[model samples]
Target: MAAASGTRPEHMAPAEVFYDGTEAKKYTSSSRIIDVQAQMAHRCIELMALPPGHRCFILDIGCGSGLSGEALSSAGHAWVGTDISADMLTVGLARGTPGDTLLSDMGQGLPFRTGSFDGAISVSAVQWLCYATQKSHQPYRRIRAFFASLYRCLKRGARAALQIYPENAAHLEMLSAAAAKAGFRGGLVVDFPNSTKAKKYYLCLVAGSGERDDSAAAATSAAGAAAGAAADSSSSSASDGDLKHSDAAMEATDGMGSAMTSSGLVVAMGRRSSSDFEKRRRSRAQDRVGAHAPARKEWVLRKKEQRRAKGLPTRSDSKYTGRRRPDRIT
Candidate 1:
């Protein structure tokens, strides 16, 4: 069946693949959000000062391809990531990074038991929830639900860092209000000295000791259904629908019965930081590559040696590790 006039955004659909698209691809190579990583490491180091078992349990929501996970793992923090796109997850899984990765939708209530996470972080992913709404779709609530679900899964006394885009007063107000209502405290931090786009935003929210909001779920469900319906069909000519639908279908090379028209994301990290978050992030970005990963290379070489010894194919097109050697990243 044809997709309705407004389904997924332009950068959505096989949304997982966008992780490799130009913007994120650049961010990946250059580490544009490297500062975010440093901040995360600094906060984690501070948390480390706490007695054992006190360090935060991190959740990287929409943690596309484990970019954030790799950073957290490198710094020695326990983290788990979840996203709706398995294709993205596949890349992450292949990397064999530390921590577990789950496939789940951010717009849905997370799979964790209540308050299971110590803190949560999201990067370059929330904007998908805020895509322009059609007449009948309440895209705002999807954005709201995205935050609400994060609030529900994180423990009290924990923090959340969310970065959102198209920086404007209106969006800031929307984020602040929704977070407070969902039981998080600690005001907004706007870090843009240049322009809205360059403006780094941080919502360093501390979950309240108060009770969770009961009404968000029903409203969220209604909104998800609304998003599922795509935009209103009555207003746009049936004529346009055919053309738009045809275009969307033609663009969907990855299947999953969806496509994106346009997309953007702002990444943010949340955790317990007395104040060292920024410093830690800066230090982390500058971390030296250990002169050598001899142990790591030895392990890989041994595996290949073992395969060769056993007369098994040492190289193959398959992505499985034991099945074939790897294409190393830095």
Candidate 2:
């Protein structure tokens, strides 16, 4: 909830210390938090691309107060959730959440066995691993250990869609690198990237060789395409009021051979081709050489004329005054 208002609770305290009994109850009872968590959970499942009509045993990492677990159950999947906060798990038990809850620190690594779950989903988690709350906690090592354990617990070809609120580009890069190092294939899938409030980052990862059913792969691709379409639509809508301005700005940037977009999205607009780069390089080289080269004959003559008009003695102009002599025949 603090993250919603631009305040990161992870910065204030560790997950276990922040989400105490009072905070857990408040988070569970908030309608907005419940709805947002549910939406993100559904999106995570979509990104997972689980087979249709088949029940899956999923792992819900950092399933705070079982809100996201409730979503997994709604999709007809059985999920076991793990959280670092005991009070949160207690509150989830009191609420009669469908999934079983375990009290464990994810940064220490998941407790599940190898290939135990069909897929995994995490909502508003993972970012905590990038921060060190204890003296023994090394962000990179903890991230590496957590991802390694998660990768082992997942069946080959299974996916884990973890929705994280990265603090910055560096944190995002660290998490991604750690996941890749753990042997998971795939990359980040960002939805509604143009909107500050609606933008979400999902690290969609595949376990092992990624030899999954074709239908599942198609589903994943379709989901990614749909997210792209949504982002485009949102961007277009946001710039509708300033369409002409946006177009003009884009044109100016393009004219300058810049690869930046007018709306500041990651989408590149005026990427120069190889020939364009070559031409620009040649032009710059010519300018650098010309800056230090001797003045042309016409320039020397003009300067002499200016000196004469200033009443200073100047060289007389003749046919050869600004002409170079021919080379003698060898």
Candidate 3:
């Protein structure tokens, strides 16, 4: 299929057609794919931030060959994996992947009852919904239906971390918008954003509002305790002024950084100080003034000095430096 044509499998053929018995075997046998999938699965679990030591019933959507499902099992969770490819499921079964495997298409929707799962995760799968290989397949509608079904299957406040490799900005926006329309709250989280190949995207969605509030409260309390411990340690190691300066710098740089608690709840931590805000406001005002201000002797000299320091071509300062020329007689 796609492998034979040297094109991306998603673009070459439908997932079911692309991941046939040969591809399923090849995928499961590859050490690199296995490692990457495992790493991604663990990261997804970390992003889920489920309660420590608590066993969860997780749904693995598009769980090709049960690679991600294996991760769930290792993490002491019971998972039910659903995939569009029967060959992949068969291979997973042969490989003895932990938990159940079902032959199903996620685009058609998850075949589970309401609140059937504690949480959900998908790896390199959700992006498939953005493509329409078949004539009847409407990408937007399929995405909406899949997300709505996912929303209904998750318990209130439960989260789903769907790892996707979107084709472009439009695909990413469409997937996120569809999730939002399906009543899932939250946003996309990108990891290793600067790295092209290493970068990954996860749509971190919450099923409902109540669990979100509870998770936030829990994260806040946990963050407070952690902050207190950190402060105590810093106080012991550094002077009070140094500690305050460091804290202020952190607040300025990490304005409202997210903290994920044990309960899979992400909460915003840290706040921009009033002093920081005032500084930024003053800097902006200075920029505005500088934009229109007439060049003064000091400003011109300062710019020349900066250019000179940077090893750029700069004329030597002379008696006429920054001096205004006499207006030409009209």
The better-scoring model by TM-score among 2 and 3 is 2
Instruction: Compute each candidate's TM-score over C-alphas.
Output: 0.51, 0.70, 0.66
Candidates sorted by lDDT, best first? 2, 3, 1
Residue range with the least summed lDDT across 10 consecutive positions in model 3: 237-246
Q: Candidate 1 at 274: error in angstroms?
A: 29
lDDT of 3 by residue, 232-273 (tens): 344221212111012222222122123222222233212346
RMSD of each: 24.4, 12.0, 13.6
Q: Total backbone clashes of model 3?
A: 1
Quantify all predictions' global Cα lDDT against the true fold: 0.51, 0.76, 0.72
Candidate 2 Cα misplacement greater than 4 A, ranges: 1-5, 213-218, 231-330
- Point out where model 1 deviates above 4 Å: 1-17, 20-54, 132-137, 192-198, 210-330
What is the C-alpha lDDT profile of model 1 across 3-28, one tens digit per residue? 35534333344344444444333443
TM-score of candidate 2 versus the correct structure, residues matched by position: 0.70
The superposed Cα distance between candidate 3 and the true structure at residue 160, in angstroms, equals 0.2
Winner of 1 and 2 under TM-score = 2
